[model samples]
Target chain A: MTQGMSLIVKTITRLVTSFITLFGIYIVLYGHVSPGGGFAGGVILSAGMILLLLAFGREQTMKIISHSALVIWDSAGALAFLTVAVVGYLAGDFFINFLSTGEPYRLASAGTIPLSNMAIGAKVGAGLFGVFLALAIFRPGRHQEEE
Target chain B: MDPFMLLLLALLAFMIIGSLIAAETEDLLSSVVCVGAIGAGLAIIDLFLGAPDLAITQVVVEILCVAILIRVVLNRKDETHRTHKDTFAVGSVLLFLGVLLVLGGWAMTTLHPFGEPLLAGDQPGVAQQYLTNGLQDTGAANYVMAVLLDYRAYDTLGEATVIFVSIIGAYVILRQRGKLRHDTGNESDS
Candidate 1:
């Protein structure tokens, strides 16, 4: 139901959405060394997508990332996380720390934690955006009810 | 009181006032903006309380919530105007809310004072162990991430599954062209 906004708002959105996405990636990757992890980062990423949906209109955004592709990403993220758990189970425990615990504070140190963060980030971002898209598409009572 | 205490109190008061305004606003778009302000206040309070992760999440959520609510409300039918007022219903609801707030305030008094965490007393709970040895065990600087993904990875997996299912549920509920449409019902056009 959303249409492209005024020139000023669209220009501002184009400039800011990429920065929001970049910060989300930083938060997800450096979650072990800093505060935000997969969940917060993923939500931010979806918020960036929502911004795009608002600024450029829903049809154009859907062209970039289709519904089927998003669903695939959502399932893939969940599967990847479960795969990490099963790997630990192969090492004789449910969720044991099976990998090398490198020096703390380093980017590549947090054994399975960072990997989990990435998987969770992928899933949460995709899933939330997909939900938003579905709801937006089904929105009722707009003046332009053209299918 | 200390400056931090005063600042936190001020932020809480701002959030309370914002919520009241959001609820009372007739225009849905203005109400969404008011709720966004309350969210901004909550994020600042989280920062002051030393929860950077929560603050970041809250700010992003504030943006997303405001965006979505604005989208939903803008160019929509006007549903706020009412033909009649039900004073008794309004009075009972206000009375109920007041009683709940008093009970919540009294319950907050029973909890430990600020900045004093209640560990499992002398024995020191698993949480104490996590804080003490999390870095050595998980090799992560942030213990919160370590706890979420390493010590309790199964829980995260379960949460991911739940999210995936809920997303699917939303799609099923919102899809317009999938199955039979009950055009005969209250729906004018399906």
Candidate 2:
């Protein structure tokens, strides 16, 4: 039962997972200029990871992404976000954009906004994936009766 | 009404129908899917209302919610066992629906029509200020991003903290359960 889906689904998941992750990164990086931002992109990214878990099973997925690593990544993302905000306080205001604002519409224009978005993306993606992993791995007491 | 307005109205009707089905459905899976459909419909309506940022967020949120719900449903029993229907329960539900209809009708009559600005004498509202100066002030072309991360960053930070704390809570609760299971398994083995 833990073996997950058939070979076809696994193969398709392998083929598309990278692209989905890439698209998610694209959304995060271009959040200042695009429709999708950190939260949306992060959810999409975790969805891709979840798709992998569904296709390849929990054991195989955990081998690639250990539980401890997920916790670390999740914390790191939150810390990075807080650090960005704290850095703004150097300029006398909390979360004030202190970095030089380049020309508008450019990728580099949104001083710390893009960085903040990336931090949020990483945090949200890892947090959601961790939640999914916990829920999926949990077996209720009722399931033991069937066995 | 214009074609766009008609389309939006149609979408709203579908959303209402979807919500009704979701509420009344006997099958848990179908009910979850119906709710998801309503969420998607709401995202589309948000898009039509010229809030692409909200639309994007709504769609992604809907996807995440549906995915989590499906995961939960997969583990649980498929059949939804309804409790014995009582006359009191039925009467309360009907009374509540009737009251809701009356209140909704009254609110609609009293409130300003949809698509109109809320503030009567708009002396350049906050939204207008954000639209005009968001790009120049924040150097982010997307006004929503600018507002969320810059103009109203405190609120965003608070939300992020809440999410972080919630995740930690989940981790702690699950960890305790796993440890308890391990201890029990070892004792049985011994």
Candidate 3:
């Protein structure tokens, strides 16, 4: 199978991946004040990773981010989000805002929203990457002939 | 009509044409590209309708969908020509389209005018209330975020759970397939 694209594609991928990832992080962090949120940002981040996989080949990308590690990250993100919501129950309601609201439009404002967005961003990013990885790695007929 | 309305109408027309081309195209790659074009058109329409958040989400989702679809198509063989054709298929499709057009026309007639708030009286509606109070109550400048993560947090949690469950479901199904493959490989080796 063809490993990946040409050298030019790989170089472009290397140059753009970091910028894409940084933009995704910015979207997630400033979701409360921006047009994007966890879902969009997460997809963008995974798109960056997918671009890297396409340009660098699955083997090299896996060396950077193993499948098992992605699974753990995905699970941890979901659990963290759940924990944040469950903790809100302590404030007299399920999924309530418990923390004090600071100045509006500030990063520190919005209480637990930013944290939730981060958790969701991580979960979505890792989950999407995992799906792509699984689909790419699964070779249905590769073992059939040998078997 | 005004320039904005004219532009929006053009976009809608383009979207309709794009969808038609995507459906009619025999080449899978061209179909995928047409679908991406339609999605981008829809996003632009959403932006014109003053929903920047929706536009952003739509564009990103479109990119992901196109990528995954291209990957799937790349591995699969091109569709073969059909030797047998059913006479009733085209008739049924046209009938369905006619019914959809009728229903859509009726729905459009029943809807409130575009850009008009639904609230009738001087008292503010729920959406207006949210916009006014979102910043003070949730400390979020974006009213959409305030509503999603604060006012309607329970619903947001449900959405999160749904995503998590879906991921787990995909993982389990794939892992099972992997295990079956492994078992068969081992047996063949033995």
Q: Rank the candidates by DockQ, best first.
A: 1, 3, 2
lDDT of 2 by residue, B1-190 (tens): 7898899989999999999999997788898999899999999999889999889889888988899899888656657576899999999999999999999998889877777776532687777888888878999998889999989988989999998999999877655233555435445421
Better of 2 and 3 by lDDT: 2
Q: Give the Å error, residue A37, model 2.
A: 0.8
For each candidate in turn, the interface RMSD (Å) is 2.7, 2.5, 2.0
Tens digit of lDDT per residue, candidate 3, span B9-105? 9999999999999988888888999999999999999998999989998999899889988987876766778667677998899999999999999
lDDT of 3: 0.85
Docking class of 1: medium
TM-score for chain A, candidates 1 onward in order: 0.91, 0.91, 0.93
Candidate maximizing TM-score: 3
Clashing pairs in 1: none
Worst 10 residues of 2 chain A by lDDT: A138-147
User: Which consecutive 10 residues in model 1 chain A have the weakest lDDT in total?
Assistant: A138-147
Better of 2 and 3 by DockQ: 3
Question: Each model's TM-score?
Answer: 0.86, 0.88, 0.89
Candidate 3, TM-score vs. the true structure? 0.89
